[model samples]
Target: MTTTTHALAAPPDLGALYRRAVLSGLSGFLRRGGDLPNTTLELPAVTTDVEHLGAYARVCGFRLRDELPATYPHVLAFPLSVQLMADPSFPFPLPGLVHVRNQITQFRPLMVDEVFALRVRMADLRPHERGQQFDVVAEAVVAHQVVWRDVSTYLRRTGGRGGPRGDVRREAPEPSGLWRVPADVGLRYAAVSGDRNPIHLNRFAARAFGFPRAIAHGMWTKARCLTAFEGRLPDALLVDVHFRAPVPLPSRVAFSAHADASGWLFALHDPRRGKPHLTGSINLI
Candidate 1:
């Protein structure tokens, strides 16, 4: 019999599962805490079989119904999301787990068979009271270089899973660039990550859960930003980003970035509204 998992449900105590899995993965370059220690995940080069590349084309909004989006790599370690949920320590019923804020500073588009390791080190895990969610930050590294850093905040409610009724984020302020995120755009991005989070699709489904219309996956938006930095620096590494407001569907957005010798600065602007969605810096190795 074939086993199937609901993409949306949180994974069960996955620390052990991840521990077992990572050992067989890219353990060569990883040590408990070698200079830049982080959770490392290595994905083999994706084959060029017609079926696989077809899916990638589809994600990027291609009609071939075969191609997937270039953003697929953002979730290269997406399975880890489930792994984190599987950990018993993985905070359940917490808001931060719900991902209140998401930002991505992409250096370039990833081609097939990149064969890279995703190293994640805890950045911040503490209490925060922004809206109603718990939050955490992890500095994610790839290719022995800091590709990007992330902050994930979530929301939790009591009597749902019957755990704790609270939300928090433990981080200070950094402006985020604003982009005109459209619902149709969101639907397209969610397809790649397999997040299928109703909030990112199906307006009716979103409102049922407490969203106005479908919102873009935080990572999808991040992926679009990643495209902005491709080939601009010498071996792109070192990224900082933040999530500001939810970009709604059918809207116009302005994205702008500036890079100096020390690092690159980026921003998402809602030209009509004069508000920045996110702002951050990127340092080159």
Candidate 2:
């Protein structure tokens, strides 16, 4: 066959490859947990073994017992995630995606002794827009629950992918619940997020930042929002949250969320302290 014929025989449109990534039938093409093809991701479990933690930290480039840091799960699941994108069936380009916001809840505090299985799958996808930027959102589930979640938007600079562009035009809600943070919680979150920002781990440093105590990880506050409504609302909640303040860690607080049929409102509160820590909202289905 001539070169022209061979070239013709090959396909031109690459978007078709994404459709081949078995659509598991969710809200949108990909929206809710279990909406993508069956994929299992097993993250190495953390253990009390001293050698293991040290070695794992060295290999992962994190300090030992320094708090898992909120971003740990993303690193934990990254190796397998490569396969999903390289498979050519998924729509996202590996390096082009940008994380708009990432949040994770420290359920029982990700300790050094617990072994966790990070079950990753695609959830919630639609053309995202920020003035001129466009991208998508996918949620990651750990075990059977959605623990670490991130809304990543990808910019197809070369051309358009023509993903769903159905974005609701509405007013953004403010977070009403705010609480004063305690000291101990800061220590624990630092352990999970692997971030030892002295402001979050040391009182003296916190004083420098003008905080009475070390503050919480921004992701931790985001995680608290996620944990507050985990499995309580629709299986999939597509929210666009912007973090503005660092919640003081370990603040004993009560939270109130008054979500109407049209929108969701979240607030952080420390009834005793009588102030707001951080505020954010999610557009629930």
Candidate 3:
């Protein structure tokens, strides 16, 4: 086993990356099971673009400010994380792997003018109720300090390997606010975020795989929830979200939030199905 590395002069081409991922998926499935090695890949440090950040902030309904959005680093690190997960050595097929949850922690507000190095690794392959799961860890380092971290958990529905059972948190409440999502929301977000995953782009593209319709990006959903927290959020905080169901394009959904002893508990759900699209908590660290 060897550590693979790439120094990107510019951001990755998501289309090409996905094609490669598809091929890797075919290879991994043929090999059955494998181990997730603890090798780290360091991507080139990138200087944030003010214009890009402003566009992302607007699309995600966040306030445009001097500081980068708390969820911005997760977007920056996504390409490398995808590469890590889709690498030929990865244990599971990329096509069926579900992004079940994401946890992000920001040590402090990061400025748009700063340059940060992104490091990505994978670990903790475990079992879930319906399948197997693992985590992709991404970190942002500015100067010599770690400024941000994101743990993205993905599930592959392959029965169970008897790994330890993960945490079991209480269910969030029914949503209090309703939102009508437009079909173009996914394309609009992809334009700014550089995530062109076909599953989120169009109905035809989505059905090419397995989804009945295009689904919203999990990160977009998380960002929108954070946007709602705006003024109430601390500069340093931790946000953990579990994605329960896909929010199909041109659909309506609901949102709810309440205060708990640890922090704020929030959820987005589909009223018709009585199922959560996402549930999360905000912990002030």
Candidate 4:
């Protein structure tokens, strides 16, 4: 399919994009379509903010360093993805979409001062048991070479015929460590990441969506896991994860991981109930 590209001269205004998302969500019922827009949004000559990177590291438990975390590119490319989804031609509202899975591939570690270009697009709309699912693909290109890429899968709840589940059941391993996730984690992460979804920021807002309280961002959980493997991961690698359940703020969760020749398998779970919050693996590329 032919794809149309929009080049942004400056970083997108996330606040404006979020306002559009809220309006789109409020009138989502009026939308009637299943097709994704065949368009790509590009932001060129992007550079990192040192202060913001430090803040992001603090919130996600990554040690401050000159090299960017594997998940960092997602943070940079997120605004483009938001712009693509907020377009009137997009089918689903951005507010209620569930982040069901994420897979990121880092060809090599990115340095803190390096400049890159970001490109984002939507693809692969398909049926799910409870709704429809689609992918938002983002890439970070440095000096004309693609250095990092990520595919974030989101589910939009609507009527649908049942489909096969992608997750596989596995026994929970013994805890390697325990984390006391703070209640303000969502707020802190949002300050740096620019993802201020109501379901992750306030109790009353979350209640409006049937959640008991605000939940931690899925990307935060993924980043925290990578933090645990810091200094041990390969320079080129792939991390794939399936989000299993919401982690209510101010909750305690257990983390576990086992290493092999290929890479590492890791998970975060409820310490008491043994219910997984996230399950994933990191493999050398």
Candidate 5:
């Protein structure tokens, strides 16, 4: 496969990229191909803004610190992923793509002042039991070394069969904590994360997408789960999570975490229904 690369001087405006994504969704219906684009987008140098970082930390429940959180790089690279998925050559519409899974491997904790390069590409297009899935892989580099990487798997619901089922059945664990997720949590996170997906913003918008009410962003749940292990996690480690069900806005949810020899297993579930919302694990590297 021949890969084409495009490098930008700075990060693209996420607002503009989001507009393109919505327009692409409308044009996607006329698209007839089923092949993923073999392309990559890169930002040569990127650094964190202290205010932005603080706002993000507050929203995700992380303490403000010099060292960046494990999930922070994803925020930096997200616009590039949006650009890739919104391109005309891409196979899927960006608006409805569901982020079903995410894996982040941090080689070492990155500092707030460090400058890093970012590269994002699409890969691993395959079938799923309910739809087709692909990976948006992003990497953060400093001094020619990859310091952090993330693979976010998005599912495009196209109605397929005989593919692997992504769901895992597990009994709900005892609650370690209870959280009262506010109705505007999605909007708050979106303000910082640039993920203003309609399904997460307002009830009216969510209804257009077939959701009863606005839902929380999946990444927010993952970040919130990590907050429980803040200052306790290894510097170099892997965090993997599967989004099981959406957490509706203004809901009560339970969080559980168990530790063993290798690492920690964690999950967020609906306490009343005994249904899992997000299940994840962390492994020391």
Candidate 6:
């Protein structure tokens, strides 16, 4: 198989990306990876901004300190990943594809002024119990050294046969703390994260996309969970998350976490529905 590469002048604009995604729709998603060739997108090395990182920290409930947050690099590389997925040849619709899971590794604490190249590639398409799924690999490099990496698994629901049934674990205990998620959290997050998906921004926009109302960003939920574990996380760590359900805007939910031999196990669930919003673990490396 041949690999094709595109050099991006700068990060992609979500508006343009949305236009392309709508044009491709489900047809592109269903046929992705069957015979399509692999492709990668690369962006020139760029310096990080302290102010920008600080803004992200504020929204995600993290205090802005000297070092960048562990999850911040994901935000930096996400646009490039979107740019790859939005390609006409790529196999997935932008709005409907669910981010089922994410795995991120940080080798060390990244300072704000560090410069790094961003690369994103899509591959590993296969069957799932619910539908077909694929993995998008994103990396951040500092002076040719890999400093952080993320593998984002996305699902396109087509209800195909084969593969193991979704794993079911015992329900976690009731959360000890309750959180009142506001309606504008999506907008606030989008402002810093550069992920302005309309489904997460407003009820009207979410309805257009077949959701009852706007939903919170999955990364925000993950970041908030990590924030709660601040002063406890090791310098090198791995954060793995599986998004179980969507948390509608302006909703009240439960948050809980506990430390184990592996690291920290955490969860967010909606009290009203008695369903999990997301479940995740943090492991020291």
Q: Please give the CA lDDT of all the candidate structures.
A: 0.46, 0.45, 0.81, 0.89, 0.88, 0.81
Give lDDT: candidate 5, residue 66: 81
Question: Residue-wise lDDT of candidate 1 within 29-50, one digit each (tens)?
Answer: 2322111112323332223334
Q: After superposition, how far is residue 152 of candidate 5 from its true place, in Å?
A: 0.2
TM-score of model 3 vs. true structure: 0.89
lDDT of 3 by residue, 69-109 (tens): 88888888887777776667777767767788899999998
Q: How do these models rank on TM-score, best leading?
A: 4, 5, 6, 3, 1, 2
Q: What is the C-alpha local distance difference test score of candidate 3?
A: 0.81
TM-scores of the models, in the given order?
A: 0.57, 0.41, 0.89, 0.96, 0.95, 0.90
TM-score of 4: 0.96
Name the top lDDT candidate: 4
- Clashing residue pairs in candidate 4 are none
- lDDT of candidate model 1 versus the reference: 0.46
Regions of candidate 4 where Cα sits further than 4 Å from its true position: 160-165
Better of 3 and 5 by TM-score: 5
Error of 2 at 261 (Å): 2.3
Question: RMSD, each candidate, Å?
Answer: 11.2, 14.7, 3.1, 1.9, 2.0, 2.8
Error of 1 at 168 (Å): 19
Q: Candidate 6 — which pairs collide?
A: none
Badly placed stretches (over 4 Å) of model 1 are: 1-72, 86-89, 94-111, 114-124, 131-182
Error of 2 at 117 (Å): 14
Q: How big is the positional error of residue 108 in model 1, measured in Å on the Cα after superposition?
A: 11
